[model samples]
Target: MIRTLPLLLAVLASPALAQGLTDLDEVDRQVSAFVGQPTPPVDRRLRLARCTAPLALDWYGNGRQAVQVRCPVPAGWTLYVAMPAAAAAAAAPPLVQRGDSVTIQVGGDGWAVSQPGEALEAGAAGAWIKVRGLVPKAPVLRGRVLRPGLVGVDLP
Candidate 1:
C-alpha cells in the first residue's frame, strides 16, 4: 500500500496543476461586489504554456494592494494563460501563483487588447488570444473570466 502513495500523489497534483483554477466561491463574491454586478459561475481553462504572452494587471492606489498577477494551474489539466503577441508587448504577462489566491478575479471589462482575436496554434483545443489586465483597476479586489470571451476597449 505504501507504493500506492506515489501514484495517489501524482493523480492529485495532476488535476490541480493542469486543470486551472476551480470553484473559487469566495473569490466570486468579492468580484461581484467589486464590479457591482451579479456574479455568475465561471470555470474555464487556459493552457499557460501556449500563452506566449501573459495576463498583466497593475494596481494603483490604496485598498487591496494588487501587487502582481498570476494564473498558476491549481489543478493538473494542461493549464495556461495567454494573450496576443502584440498584446504581450502592450501589457505585462499574467501572474501565476503556486498556491491558490481567491483575491484575483477576472471580468469581461477587466481587460483591453488590440482586438479580440484568436488562433488554434498548431492544433490546440480552445479559442485563444493575448490580453491586458483582467480588471485594470487598483481597488479591483477580484476578477473572473467572462463567458463568450474578450471585448474591446477604446485605446486612449
Candidate 2:
C-alpha cells in the first residue's frame, strides 16, 4: 500500500480554510437577491448587502499589506466569508464584541452584501464599511482583516 503518512498528516493537521475570506460568497448570496450568478456585470452593479456580527462570534483575517486594509468581500469555491472575528483575536487589537456591521462594497462604489459564486472586482475592493472609508492598503507593516471595507484608502 502507498504511504499515506503525508496525506494523513495533512488531513489531521489541516485547519478549517475560510473559502470566502472576502465577502464574495455573501456577495453571491445578496447578488442573487437582485440578480443571479454568471449574470451580466451591469446587472451585478451597485448591490448592497450587510452583515451584523458580534465580535465574539466570527472574525477572520482580511490579509493586509500596510494599514491592515484590503479587507475584501468573501470569494471562495467553498465556505463563505469568514467573519473578521476569527481574525480579530489574531489582530493587534481584537474587534469590539458589541456589534459590527460589514457592508461589502460591490459594483464600483455600489455597496452591498456579497453573494456566493460572485467575483470581486478591482473596483469593488474596499476597507471598513463602518469606518476609515479607504481603499486597500497592503504590504502593511503588519496585520489582517480588521473591519468593514472602506470606500477610499490612502497609504503613505
Candidate 3:
C-alpha cells in the first residue's frame, strides 16, 4: 500500500491535471462549427487539459470523422474528440446519404470525365468519401460529397 502512494502522487502531479480540465460543451461547440453540422452530446468520461490560450480544432486524420483539439501553448497537450458512433451516422445532412446514386467527376485543368456512380459512404456537404464508379472493374474512388446524387473528384 505504501509503494502505491508514490504512483498516486505522480499521477496527481501530472501536467494534465495541473493544467485543469476543459468543458465538454465548449469542445462540442467548436467541433460542430468545424464539421459544418450540429454534433450530439460528448461522452461523460471525456476530459481534456484546459486550454488557456487559443484553441485550435482540426480534423483528426484522413478518412476519420473525429476532431483533434490542441493548445498552442508550451507544454500543451492534444486530445481527440470523436462523436458518438450512432450520432455520426444519423447526423449526415440530407444532401448526401449512404448508398445514394451520385455522379463522380474526375478532372483537372478545366477538363474531366463525369461518370455515374454510387456513394459508398454517408457524408455532409464538402465531406470527402468513397464512391464506386459504375464501369466494370473500376476502382472505388474518393470524392467530395456535393449535393443529392452528386460527388466531385479533383484531379491532380
Candidate 4:
C-alpha cells in the first residue's frame, strides 16, 4: 500500500491526467436550449481544451443562424456551431448580385484600404463570394459580403 501510494500520486500529478477536455454533452445542451430544439452532437474531433470560466454563447452570423461558442481567455477558444437547416433557410435574402459594383475593404490593426471591385457571384450579407478589382489584370479575391456594395477581405 505504501509503494502504491507514490505511483498513485505521480499519476494524479501528471498534466495529461489532471486537465480534461471540455464536455461535448454540455455544449449540446446549451446550444439546444438557445435554439429551442435539440442540437446535433458536437463533433468529438474538435477536442477543445477544458474551460474554467463559464462558456459564452452568441449568434455568429448576420442571419443569426449559427451559434458562436466561446471559452474565455485562459482557454481562449471558440467554435461555430451551425443551426439546423430550417433555421438557415430562413436567413436574410441575397444582398449582392453577380457583376455588381462593390467596395472591397481590407483592414488590420490601425489601417484600412478600400478599392472598387466587381462581384463574381451573388451572396447574402455575411456570405463569402468571389470578387475582382476593377483595374486591369487585377487578381480575383474572395471576401465576405458586409452589405450592399461592400465586402470585407480577411488577411492571413
Candidate topping TM-score: 4
Best lDDT among the predictions, by candidate number = 4
Tell me the deviation in Å of residue 136 in model 3. Answer: 7.8
Clashes of each: 39, 51, 0, 0
lDDT of 2 by residue, 78-112 (tens): 22233232232233343322123233233324444
TM-score of 3: 0.42
- Using TM-score as the measure, what is the rank order of every candidate, best first? 4, 3, 1, 2
Candidate 4, residues 92-112, lDDT tens digits: the string is 578899999999999999999
Error of 3 at 119 (Å): 9.7
Tell me the TM-score of model 4: 0.49
Off by over 4 Å in 2: 1-20, 35-156
Which 10-residue window of candidate 4 scores lowest in summed lDDT?
Answer: 84-93
Candidate 3 off by > 4 Å: 1-19, 83-156
Better of 1 and 2 by lDDT: 1
